[model samples]
Target chain A: MKILVDTLGADKGYEEIVKGALKALENHNNLYLTFIGNEEEIKKLVKNNTDKINYIDTNEYIKNDEEPALAIRRNKKSSLHLGLKALNEKEYDGLISCGSTGALLAGATLITKRLQNISRAALTIVFPTEKNPCVLLDAGANMDCPPELLVQFALMGSVYSKGVLNTNNPKVGLLSVGTEEGKGDKLRKDTYELLKNSDLNFQGNVEARDLLSGNSDVIITDGFSGNVLLKSTEGTAITIMGRLKKGILGSFKAKIGALLLKDVLKDVKNMLDYNEYGAAPLLGVKKAVFKAHGSSNARAIETGIDAMVKFVENDIINKIEKELAKKEIEE
Target chain B: MKILVDTLGADKGYEEIVKGALKALENHNNLYLTFIGNEEEIKKLVKNNTDKINYIDTNEYIKNDEEPALAIRRNKKSSLHLGLKALNEKEYDGLISCGSTGALLAGATLITKRLQNISRAALTIVFPTEKNPCVLLDAGANMDCPPELLVQFALMGSVYSKGVLNTNNPKVGLLSVGTEEGKGDKLRKDTYELLKNSDLNFQGNVEARDLLSGNSDVIITDGFSGNVLLKSTEGTAITIMGRLKKGILGSFKAKIGALLLKDVLKDVKNMLDYNEYGAAPLLGVKKAVFKAHGSSNARAIETGIDAMVKFVENDIINKIEKELAKKEIEE
Candidate 1:
């Protein structure tokens, strides 16, 4: 399978991106990667030997602060825009970028366009829960979503959960203030109705308190609520972990125990790490697109590539299209 | 010195509620309590109670699923409604209830009424952060709030942070998806502008990821967003602690280490415990009204009573009224 990698906009810069791409290829012999960035820098990083590596040259990159739509519209020569265009052109089976989330989503939507029968494509994050990793979307793709858009998010999330997470018949839920049917505002109530009538295994409304209990495999929400939930969870985890580390360091007893529990703590941290999950798929785009965290390191980028490989090999895009088509027919 | 305790709707029965009231009075000698609920039930628990404890007869209680407005209007005989009425009548300096959040807010607004120059009353929660506890509001009050309502939330949160948390001139922040200006949806953008112009120590937009980092002493957002953030944080904390416990129990090494570090873990748990913070105040009300957690225990109820005593003794309601009135006059 062939994948396009945009080597810009990540926190560690181009060196880490190049090393990550090389590491991905070293791990997967069948995996082919097209590196899109400055030609001279790529050549220098690879030491003028671009064996089994396809290079696409582009020095310009979109800034994180740039207006997403304007950046996509204007930065035709940028690596992200060019990589997305190439993915849309079917030159690569999938695309991976550690760029700004807004730029990536905007570029994927405007350039690659939405999949057939899908009104809005959602950005989904697969984060760890107690039982297993669950899919949460839309994680900041379309902020002001209507009931219909949320329905589409649920549908897309279900397809991704089944195809990628191997969760057969993923239970879908609408995030709300309460688990009751009529608990939330107008949009949530309307979306709850829509989800209830859908073909997926609908679990009605799921409150935030139940989010990490693996009550539902797929949790659908508007970009605003989803983003808030994701970040709040992230912040809470960081704070708790930091506090734990502080506690261990503060007392001699804790410090002694920490030595024996070092591996256990590492396991817990790894369980909660987003890096292991790799990239968040921007589902609903015509082509497969995955977004790695902006601060991704070499290891994270490698996992992102592995995730893309799975997406391409399993034909996730085709499966999503088929499921959406079936839903459309049923409707 | 007088406080109203609604002895109904808690997960525990009246025995626990009465015990909690006694515990509160035990902590503060000057505190006088008026227990409002079933007279026979409370009398049995407080059999021959001393002079500080006063009893009122009421058996009615609001259900969690009952409509807030309808419940407030029809259940005037309910403990929550009657307690709020007494608070409004100046019979009690403050009121506490471990009842449904919707019922408490509705009763407080309709019976106790809002303070002068306040259009909406916000529910504020104080939770642990890395540095210190921060105030977040409106946790679940006004679902769809205008920019002006958010400004009021900030003002009220600032007063609560000062009067309760003792953070003088508290730095208030508008919670958003991003910290950058003009990043979030229209509501957040507008709220940012309103907050920037306010006299309170406004600290601009704060992302959800920085929420538990104690970036701001008071974080203000619309009810929908604030509720999602609050619950998400709570859920994440619960999930992480559960995972840590599970890890400790699964491995012999971890179990031994956990034994050694038990005190540290308990300290960590205590730091994150919601019960330690007592009750969330329904700010903007004419009188101090606190909504204790619905699933509160005797100890939690005791803390809620302690919080009410502090609010009443510090004259927080009058202070909020004065600040709001001063702002109105200045405008």
Candidate 2:
């Protein structure tokens, strides 16, 4: 499960991340795809079946309008800093990068860092919601923090919904503007009294109009209100699907009722596809960086390398570093 | 343009608010409506047409899960405090309410107050988007503030995008978590250095995924990040149109292409209807309260009395007290 791919920072470059890493090496036969950047455009998009992909050659990329801390101090051999120096030499258990979300949070916090009692870190994004697909988090990874880093982003988004959305305990919420206990500000009434005296599953204050009534499975906030509630729900679901395709193709009997729901509107646009929940977890990184969405394509970078191979088979950063070292040895 | 309206805080009471004010006085005519409450249940739902419409009894009726500041002090003869005491007796020209958005912001700040150099008051909404319909403001109103009340909520959201979405000058922004000029907190870096030396039209910051793009026609924030970017864009457009209606009714050639796009999925559920832009406009009140969505129905209380007869025949509270007294004499 060795994943490192940046393959020239997204918007589908280098032949759709070398044909989505040869369709995830035909479903992970000991996966190894490294391909960072321009080694003859990823050797003609991984041609001549290049022994299950590899090539960190690099050629500066991070340009989604530069200045992410001055392009990680003027491009230290860029390709998103050589894919955050191969996940800071864990060689690659995880680290994908569709690219330039401010140069993957300034080259993954200057090549892997922030872990012990993580003060600021976040990029969550879950979204399949109707019940489970809620987790929003630092959708804007720290612009300014401390409400005890949103109570450690609600215990790192309920330790990624009880270790990778399996969710048995989860429940937490603090995306504010009232659920009371003297509602919001002073950093959400001091992170709602440190997440209602910490333990987790704290569901108290959540109202941004009842976040799609599947309510709390870890919503958290700050990274500037989870990057404006993950870009105002990705620009109001692309302006309510661009006014539902101009109000159903602006009449002709709503374009023959949108051509009889055009193949069930492309399977309801692949279940409100944010590339069907691909990659976002930047969390309090030690290994998994994730990022994707520099206009991710090829099925959102094969759903960001199957969400970095389900965070390297759900080690989930050593269970969020043993739940922040057992909440720092019980404070 | 009279207005008043509580008709005993709706839950389909006062017979669907007198059948949505006799279907908005049969398409408005410089109307007058009033209707406070229990005048024998709004004269048995406007029977024998009591000369068009107007009532005022009010033996009270608040409940809708009470606690909106103790249901406006245990219902002072309710009807949301006699329809905000007839918009503080200027003989109404504004005052709607479907009921309890914390009892209409604690009865419009303890009965129609803050409009002189308006210190606190917000609730805006108007979203709609796909390039038109923008305005979001403190959509839940004050859940803790200061960055000079979000730089007087970006000059009352640039005088509500030039007086109710007419946008002559608009472009205000500042929702933050990037679009830099010192990315957020400390109230978005002190409201982006007083909206980069004010005189409005700032446009410096805007991320909650570009709040339903049209980019900015007044965005602002803080009402706990504008109620978590208005309830995570109403829970990601009802969780991406309920997984695009169960992946377009999962089955049989997508059920014959979703019955030929049933009028383009009701034009994508009326372009993601947030009650098709009904209430919300309590902006630094002195009149015109608005609110609406308390399960509104009756065509969202006749589009919240046509947004209070276009904010009472468009003199929007003397043009927001002369452009907030000309931005407090140009600060």
Candidate 3:
């Protein structure tokens, strides 16, 4: 399978991206990649992995501070824009980028376009929950979503959960302040009504406090709130871990205890780490598009590539299209 | 100081509430309390400490499932309603309730009335953070707030932080999905402008991830998002601690390590516990009102009463009123 990789805009630089791409290529002998970035630097980094790799020579990229839509529109030769263009026109099965999320999302939507009957595409992530990894969307793709858009997110998240995450009959829950019906703001209340009417396994409303309890297989929220949820979870984990480290070092006995429990703590850390989970899929697009975290290390990139390959293999695009079409017909 | 305690609607039952109130009364010899619940039961609970205590005999109370506004308006004799009414009419210094948050907020707003120039009341919580305990407003009060209301929240939050929490010139922040200026939904964008123009120490937008980092002294958001942030942090902490406990119990060596680090873990748990933090103050109301968590045990209720005493001692309600009035005059 051919995949396009935008080897720029990541915080760690392109060398790490090249290393990760090479590792993915080594693991999947059948995988071919087209790298879009500074050609000379990437070539020097890639060394002998030239057979299955192609290059689009351009150092142009979108900065994090630039307006996303305007940057994509103006910077035609930028790695993110070119990668999306290639993914749309070429035979590549998917595209991966560790770029500015806004630019990548904007380029993907404008260049690759949305799937038929899909109102807006959503950024879907598999977050680690107490019971299992649960699917959450729109993780900062569409900021101001109407109730109808949330309904679409629920449908797409359900498809992604079942088709890619391998959850059978995933339970979809709307994120709200309270778990009871008519508990949240207007968006949540309206979305609750639509979700209850849909064919999906609607689990009513799920409070934010129940987010990590693994109460629902698929959770849907507006991009703004979803982003808040994802980031809050990340920040809280970091703060707690930092405090624990401080506590462990402050006392001699605790230091000894920490040394003995090092392996167990490492396992817990790994379970909560975003690197192990790979990239978040930008669902509802006509083509497969994955966004790796900007600070992703080489290992994270390799895992992200693996996740993208799964997306391609599962034919999530076609499945999403079919699902949306069926829903339209039902309506 | 006279305080009104609504000994009903708590998940742990009135016995816990009575026990907590009695404990508070014992600690503060100058403090007097009026209990609003089942008269006979409360009198029996407060048998020896009857000197500084009074009773309003009534078994009527608001249930968790009842609509908050409706219940408060219809059930005049309910503990929550009676307490709020007494707080509004009598010489009570403050009122504390472990009741439905909606009912408490509605009754507080309608009966006690909002401070002059205050458009709406807010539920404010003092949450533990990395640096210090920071104040967050509109925790679950007004879910659908306009830009103006959020501005009021920021003002009230700043006053409460400086007056009660003792943060010197508290840094006020508007909560959003991103920390950058103009990086969130319409409410955030509009609120950003208002906060910028206001006299309060307006730090720009703060991302939810930074909520626990203590980047700002006072964080303000619409109730919906604030609740999501609060609950998400709580949920993530619970999930992590649960996993750590399971990890500790899974191996003999880990268990030994945990025994050594028992005090350290307990300290961490206490730091993150809501019970230790006390009840959330409902700001902007004419009188001091506090909402303890529904699941609060005796310890939490004692802490809640202690916090309410501080609120009254600091005269936060009048301070908030002055701040709002000053802002209005400046405008």
Pick by TM-score: which candidate is best?
A: 3
**Docking quality (DockQ) of candidate 2:** 0.29
Better of 1 and 2 by DockQ: 1
**Candidate 2 backbone collisions, by pair:** A208-B231, A228-B208, A231-B208, A231-B209, A232-B208, A257-B261, A260-B260, A260-B261, A261-B260, A261-B261
Candidate scoring better on DockQ of 2 and 3:
3
For candidate 2, the docking band is: acceptable
Kindly provide the TM-score of model 2 when superposed on the true structure, using C-alpha atoms: 0.36
Candidate 3 residues B231-320, lDDT tens each? Answer: 999988988898899889899999999888888888788779889887999888888888999888889889899888888888887787
Query: What are the runs in model 3 whose C-alpha is more than 4 Å off?
Result: A47-49, B47-49
Q: Assess each prediction's global lDDT (C-alpha) against the native.
A: 0.85, 0.74, 0.88
Model 1: how far is A66 from its true place, Å? 3.3
In model 2 chain B, which range of ten residues has the least summed lDDT?
Answer: B41-50
Positional deviation of residue B25's Cα in model 2 after best superposition, in angstroms: 18
Q: What is the lDDT of residue A327 in candidate 3?
A: 84
> Every model's Cα RMSD, please?
2.5, 20.7, 1.8
What local lDDT score does residue B328 receive in model 2, on the 0 to 100 scale? 79
Q: Estimate, for each residue in B262-329, the C-alpha lDDT of model 1 and write its tens digit.
A: 88888889878888888898999888888888778788888888888888778888888888888889
Alpha-carbon error at B88 in model 1, in Å?
2.9
lDDT winner between 1 and 3, please give it.
Answer: 3
Fnat per model, in the order shown: 0.69, 0.80, 0.86
**Mind giving the per-residue lDDT tens digits that candidate 1 earns over A1-331?**
7889899888889878788778888787787778999878877777432566798898888988899889988989998888988887655788889888888888888888888888777889997887878999999887778898888888888878887789988999889898888888788989888888878899998888888888799999988888999999988888888888888999899998888788778877987798878789999987789898888888888888887787777888888888888888887
